[model samples]
Target: NAGVIQTPRHKVTGKGQEATLWCEPISGHSAVFWYRQTIVQGLEFLTYFRNQAPIDDSGMPKERFSAQMPNQSHSTLKIQSTQPQDSAVYLCASSLQGGSNERLFFGHGTKLSVL
Candidate 1:
């Protein structure tokens, strides 16, 4: 367990609703990951695994944003009261080792549209 897990490959939600994204990291990999992508900011790091723990979620909104790693195989990101500004592709990744220089295996990403 490391960070959020985004699923569905695509998600659409009305404004003020909730969006829960799921991600299942590669088995045997020690690190799980999450990222957000928008045209304005490109790709932004949300969280990552380090020594089996998650660290550095500075990119996530202070409010209406949360991530959890309940187990080693999966993680989740929940957005409460979704907003249009929250629309973006949520990416999940995993690495054999947890480190800044380690290679990552990335999912296609879950596209979330908040209307």
Candidate 2:
């Protein structure tokens, strides 16, 4: 079966521009997680959804970042007023279900570059 799918493999944004990234998890899976990866920060958990509802968003930037799962198969991450500091790889991972014992399958990710 195919793993998670993330669209636009790369994104280029000017300072203050908006960037929208998409993710489509594997069929029949319910847990979706968003993470930001960079050399200095390593991997940072942005948020997650369990059964289409938000589970945790403690890692999201207080102002410019947000995530949503409107349906079963897909999710989106939106960043407003994108800044140079926001330039990083945004990865989306999914599990069969929410809870322990679920293995995460990651998408190729959307590499965002803010100019």
Candidate 3:
């Protein structure tokens, strides 16, 4: 299996622009998750899907950010009006079973830089 694949390992955008990060989960995996990594928050869970269904997303910012799993194999994280503060390493993870405590394998992550 290819494991989780996050495209555009690095991205740079101007403030007020939009940024979209993509992820391809492992084959046959039922759960895919999104997270943001930063010095302050460490690994902050953003959202996830189980069996291609949206699950919890309370940790995500109410505005300017959104996550979606359109199919079993892939998911996307979109940020509108990107700001300097939004710059961070966006990570995607997946596991065979879906649960908060389940062991997850993570992608290398997409580093977003805003200027």
- For each candidate in turn, the TM-score is 0.89, 0.97, 0.96
Predicted structure with the largest lDDT when compared to the true one: 2
> What clash pairs does model 3 have?
none
Per-candidate local distance difference test: 0.84, 0.95, 0.93
Instruction: Estimate the lDDT of model 3.
Output: 0.93
Candidate 3, residue 44: lDDT: 94
For model 3, residues 1-115, the per-residue Cα lDDT tens digits are 7779999899999999999999999898899989999999899989988998888898899999999888888999999999999989999999997865778989999999999
* Regions more than 4 Å wrong, model 2: none
Where in model 3 is the C-alpha error above 4 Å?
Answer: none
The alpha-carbon deviation from the true structure for residue 3 of candidate 2, after best TM-score superposition, in angstroms, is: 0.9
Better of 1 and 2 by TM-score: 2
lDDT by residue (12-61, candidate 1, tens digit) is 99999999998888778878778899999999998876545777778778
Question: Which model scores highest in TM-score?
Answer: 2
Candidate 1, residue 73: Cα displacement in angstroms equals 0.5
- Tell me how far the alpha carbon of residue 114 in candidate 2 is from the true structure, in angstroms, after superposition: 0.3
- Model 1 Cα displacement at 113 (Å)? 0.6
